[model samples]
Target: MLLQLISHSLGWLSAQVSAKAQDALIAVLSSGPVPQHVAFILDGNRRYARSKNMQIKEGHTDGFYTLRKMLEVCIHMNVRCVTAYTFSIENFKRSPAEVDALMDLAEEKLLELCQKGDILDKYGIKLVVVGHRDMLPERVKAAAEKAEEMTKNNDRAIFNLCMPYTSRDEIATAVQSTIHERLDEDADDTVTADDIEAHLMTSLSGSPPLDILVRTSGVKRLSDYLLWQCSEDTQLQFSSTYWPEFGMWDFVPIILDYQRKVWSKA
Candidate 1:
């Protein structure tokens, strides 16, 4: 009984410490230039799994927990929009078993989010899946559609899941859409870059130009992600940590560095 009491006491203390740390970060970020729309390239899951001698599927599952934690921090920071690179179109090249596992996990997680969508409700966050939905499994697409429908009325925040997406493909699709729209008009209409962007997958959220993009696993390259959205002032932070290891606290130094180097100058 004494040991049990001590364990409980320690847990309580740890929780308090975590809460205080989060509050401190939020207070500091609130005073500075906070990113309106932040994008994350969720990488390094396989490496993390390899390190632990775990299956690739287990690594992806761990990454989902990190995403939940990230969402909590973003909500606390009052970020207007957050985009996660959930899956890339190139991922279809993986082994069939691996691809199947990933698709199953994605479907499971989406349905779980729908059932427990109070997290979105708590923050009044609109959840939207931006990608080639037609290529997704029927059940996965159905879940995504339901999640979007359920959160359609929300306005405080927007969470975008870029599933089966690639920046190059997105840009190409946008261009095709713009041209198609122009062709629909009887008169010869000029199509501008802005018109193409308006048709982009990212445009669904009405999300502003990506203010900051974080890629984990020490990757410095964009890897065909968000090529068009990256502005001159957009701050890019490459984190050495694996996606499964990313946490709310890890965001502090990155944001602070951006403030010192980019936002302060702006």
Candidate 2:
């Protein structure tokens, strides 16, 4: 009993120390230019689950907690916009049971965020669900709309949750919207690149230009996420850490490297 107590105490103390160290580092990092918009491609939840011999749902749940923690870190860093590639349209091809589990989780989490004193309320962050609403389960779609409506007035920060989304689809939708609007106004149907960009989901949601896009589990590809939004200047960061295990420390180096590159360019 004594040994167990001592071990627990030490663990608690170590965590506290680590947290303080992280806070100090963040403060220093904040002294420099912080990215206005940062996007994350959440990957490797299933692989992480398999590695730990746990259910895939448990891995996703763990990833959600990691995401919450990373958002808090981003908020502290005063990142104006944070976009997470929560789910891709291609993810729908997964087993029906897995897809159903994901939908249930999304519904639960969206409603939880709408509750009083949750992350959205605590940080005054606006929750924007960016994707095909028709593609989501009815319950999930309702929960997403409710969350968005509840936090529409928040102006402190913006969180774009991209689920059931694909860059190709977004571009096509934007081009279509642009052409329809022009036709309705009796203008020529020539849709310029700028016109399509103005109608992009990210633009409609008021998200800032993406500055950095990080994909975990060492995945170097964008996987059809935000293809149009990623300009030549956007930094692409890849981490070997799985989504479930990603933490503040894992993110710090990326930010530092971004700062170094920006400062060097100046």
Candidate 3:
């Protein structure tokens, strides 16, 4: 019992020290340019679970907490908009049991965000679930809607959860919407790139232009996430750390590298 208590104490002390160090680093980074909008392709939860000899669900849970911690740092650093690739449309091909587990987890997290005094409420962050809502389980979809409604009035920051989404689908949907609008208005003008962009999920959700996109687990590909928004100016960062193990230290260097690029361009 004493050994366990001592171990817990040491862990707590280490976490406190790490957090203080991170805060100091953030303070210094804040004085320079910070990315106004950031996107994350959180990858490798299953691999992380395997590495830790844990269940896949447990790895996903840890990934969720890592996302929360990362968001706290982004918010503290005054990042105006953040987007996460929470689930991909391709993920539906996984085993039924795994998909069901993920749905349950999504519902639980969405409902938690809807609760008063939660992170979204406390930070005045608007929660936008961007994707094919009809594809979600009824309960999960409802929870997502509730979370969005609960935080609709917040303007301080935007948190976009792209669940069961694909860039091709988003773009196709935007194109269809743009065409339909033009048809409804009986306009002779041809559809423009700007018109489609105006109907995009990100733009409709009022998310700022993406400045940086980071994919953890050393993945270098975009994997059909935010394809249209990743212009030449967007910095793409790939980290070797898995999503569940990613921390503030893993993120700080990406920010610094982005700053360096921005400086060089100037």
Candidate 4:
């Protein structure tokens, strides 16, 4: 029995060392290329909170700070745009208390950004939000509007916050806009994909297609985010680490892998 127990302990230790070695290998092997616009699903907040026996509100609070730090790395890497899926349209299905908490947190963060926060004022980063705003509360909408107004002139970087969004809704909204924009043309003229893309609510100035998308917590699903934007050229990297737990170490390696992938295929 003693020998067996010792054997099991050794096996566990070996596995842990192997896992670290693999991460290091991934870091070393993947390097040198970064994406122009990187979008993140920002999933697993509730799970993270629950696992730690914390309230759902804490999850959003933690996520907000995590996103801010990621943006700093994005700016350091010279990424032109970073689109984050903040609140999905389907997220309303969650409990009302949780939903309300999210809305409050988001509004507060937006207000902070609009108030000339450290990052926004110092770096001159432009803040933008997309998705169904009409469904949002007045205060939330006002916060978004205020942020947009304050950052309308700044051009250093784009912080696209997707609120109450989904690919289906975005596609439908873009289609409607196309019809409105091209009213003079015959409806039967047959609109192409580009025409539809031109109308999507992603913002006017250079909302280019995302090159690399990463989702955390080991989940491998789009969850109705960024449908039309991710083309064949896009690369996705998934991690088991939760979003709140995600750090620059995770981001730096992923960017390096992206750069290598882009250049290798060229």
- lDDT per residue as tens, model 3, 142-202: 9999999999999999999999899999999999999999889999669888999999999
By TM-score, the best candidate is 2
Taking the tens digit of each residue's C-alpha lDDT, what string does model 4 give over 1-266?
Answer: 99999999999999899767756654554344556788998977888999999998998799899999888767766678999999998989999998899999989999897775568777888888888988899999999999889888888888889998898899998888788767766556677898888887774546767898899999998888887888577788898888999986787678777767777889
lDDT by residue (tens digit), candidate 2, 1-266? 99999999999999999999989988999999899999999899999999999999999989998889999999999999999999899999999999998998999999998888999999999999988879998999999999999999999999999988999999999988998899899998787889999999999999998999999998789999999999668999999999999998899899999999999999
The Cα local distance difference test for each model comes to 0.87, 0.93, 0.93, 0.83
By lDDT, the better pick of 2 and 4 is 2
Q: Please give the ranking of all candidate structures by TM-score, highest first, separated by commas.
A: 2, 3, 1, 4
lDDT (0-100) at residue 156 of candidate 3? Answer: 94
- Give candidate 3 regions above 4 Å deviation: 1-8
Q: List the residue pairs that clash in candidate 1.
A: none
TM-score of each model, paired residue for residue: 0.95, 0.97, 0.96, 0.85
Displacement of residue 130 (Cα, Å) in model 4 is: 0.6
lDDT of 4: 0.83
For model 4, give the 10-residue run with minimal summed lDDT.
25-34
